[model samples]
Target chain A: MSFITGKNLSCIRGMKYVYGKVDFTVDAGEILVVVGKNGCGKTSLLKTIAGFLKPSSGQITISCADDLQSLDIIHYIGTSSSLKKQLTVRENLTFWSKMLDSDADNIDKAIKSFGLDEMSNSQISYLSSGQIKRCSLARLLLAERKIWILDEPETALDNDSLNRFIDIVTNHVKNNGIAIIASHRPDIWPDNKKLLEIG
Target chain B: MGAFLAILMRDLRSDLRNRAQFVMIPVFYILAVILFPLGIGPETGTLSLIAPGILVVSSLFASLLALEKLFSSDISDGSFESIILCPVPISVIMAGKITAHWILTGLPLALITPFLAIMLGLSFEIALFSSLIILLITIILSLIGAMIASLVINTGKGSVLLALLSFPLFIPVLIFAAGAIDLAIIGGIGNSIAPILFLCSLTSIALPVVPIICAAIIKWQVR
Candidate 1:
């Protein structure tokens, strides 16, 4: 397992200073929930950490004995659903799995586990918001990554869907994977999770 | 190779299923070409004189229409971020996306150019030759335009900025391609072949270089 550390992390987006001189660390087998009010740069913090946004001044170092770079082991999901609307749910899963270098059999497993088998062939545009959220999160199961960065993943999910979402993240963390979730509701997080509140 | 094919296949499926975006490229090229003869008198000599240049420029602008969405839609929908997180090199993924854009707009423009050329009063041999040049020219323009689009995708007025940034880079390739097609119109293998080879060499170099630069810019800007 690697130690993911951000030293003196300062991020600026456009003219606004998102965060200044912050530091945090996460080892394998843990979940860190980022909680804050609207417009508090929670998403920006996760994005900067995901390599989507460059920090104004800081360094994120992923340390391990292996020669692998940090990006090789991260799966970053943003606020919006990443599925293509025109393609069927199954097609979106298949394509992303293929892109992520996962095998075909796993696609079916993810579909079945996420309870999307019945609507697998339906186009994403036709699915409801909760269904779309499920389809989006189902993609996580298709690939294996050491670091998972999810931004507001509970957007439109119903209570049942939210439980399934929590279960999935808990299982991943239990298996020695690291997850950093940015959401407004930290109370919903599973037990034994770390909390980082920012404004 | 797997990552490249995965992006290509995914885009191919998306473009095939919802075709209004790509269909506009060839349709716009045809519409723009038709306006030239209508706007000018239908005189054979004058129309023939302008036909090759007309085809190249119309296709260039048509390619611009497609390039804006080449990165913006993915960027908005969060798929672009997922792509970055993949283990595969972002450059190879970008190359695949650019190639898919070419297949949709460039390849179709190439296949349709001969008809537009003949309609503009070019001869059978001349139209056939110019179509091949237009095909290569379209591919080259898409590569250049895609690079610019990647840079300006998140800006306030990105489409306008993309055009402003990419058009200057496009002018040189446009001049060479139009010149080659006009040389073909002048009817000689010796003079025309050299320019055609030069144009091909340009496309070949751009094939690798443009996507790699676009990928690097995209990665840097994400931060």
Candidate 2:
């Protein structure tokens, strides 16, 4: 019973309109992929929806079953990974899990879900970009958020890592979690996911 | 409460891991305090006379030194956005952060300033009293620093802008702290209470309000 609806949503960044009058809807147990050309406002739209950027003129509505603030239920991932290079993979993940302020049990589950068993002890600075991406993605599973607004989550991910990620999202969706992903790789995404294209 | 504790621990741990970043502030404070005596001649009378004002002013500058980095690293690394997304209010998170910052810079400076006061020819008793005064001043300055740090975190000219914004704002703390220390140096402990109590009032007001205002400014500017 969780859903996000946008009516007449328009986004402006520094006097330039990224998108205008775009409408979309996403519901529980669904994956909404935003596809668009470069600089055409895919990231802008996601940021606006995630509350990072305020909409210039529009209304983005959220309806949730548990009566929580829409922002509290969302996890936004931008292009830059929030991983600290000085800390080990486990350290970084543990820090994020603590910040998410959820059950500590999910910490172990997130580590396993990201397939980070071997590299858990390695410092993030030493890990490959793909491994780092996986660590960042693990944060989503660690915190139980209803909506995940991700910006280009596929960058630097390998095929195996991508599969693991897809499996994690699939499991999340099965549990009524929502994911709003902006990616250019349609081939990597599941075939049945909904698409929202911005010009 | 959970977010606040988590942030406080994280900040303390992060600072502990990178100890040099914080160590430099106190070192600079000592060095700055030592320089005044040499530049103006080491006459005990002159040194003791200016000690209260110089120490207070120098401490104010020391607080400004690190304010720029308070949120810049988190912002550049994208950790701040995560902090902002925490379920608790942003001001609470800032309270934790500002507390951690005070522990590192202001607390240490207060402890060491008594020793610095000795260089000014002040007696050990007044030095201890002056340290107490410094503790209060630093707390108020830390709160003001936290608010101004949020204001300038995103701008390019951060340190200069911080100095510009904070120098005028900190005038009252500097005046009261110097007044308290000067009174202690001249008229003994009893005479300094008025300014010290005034500082306490300022801190009491800033303790609750500054963080909320900082959070609001952060929310408005972060986008």
Q: What is candidate 1's lDDT per residue for A46-159, written digit by digit as tens? A: 887776776689877677524323466888888888788888999999888987888898899888878899999999989998899889888888888878999899889999
- Could you give the interface RMSD of each candidate, to one decimal? 1.5, 1.9
Grade the docking of candidate 2: medium
In model 2, the runs with Cα more than 4 Å from the true position are A65-70
Q: Residues B131-204, candidate 1: write the lDDT tens digits.
A: 88888898888888988988898787987898899889999888888898888777654568877888889888
Candidate 2 per-residue lDDT, tens place, B68-162, comes to 87877777877766666767788888898898889888999999989999978999999998898889988998999889888888888888889
Residue-level lDDT for A163 in candidate 1: 88
Candidate 1 local lDDT, residue B66: 86
Model 2 clash pairs are none
How do the candidates score on chain B by TM-score?
Answer: 0.96, 0.96
Question: Model 1's CAPRI class?
Answer: medium
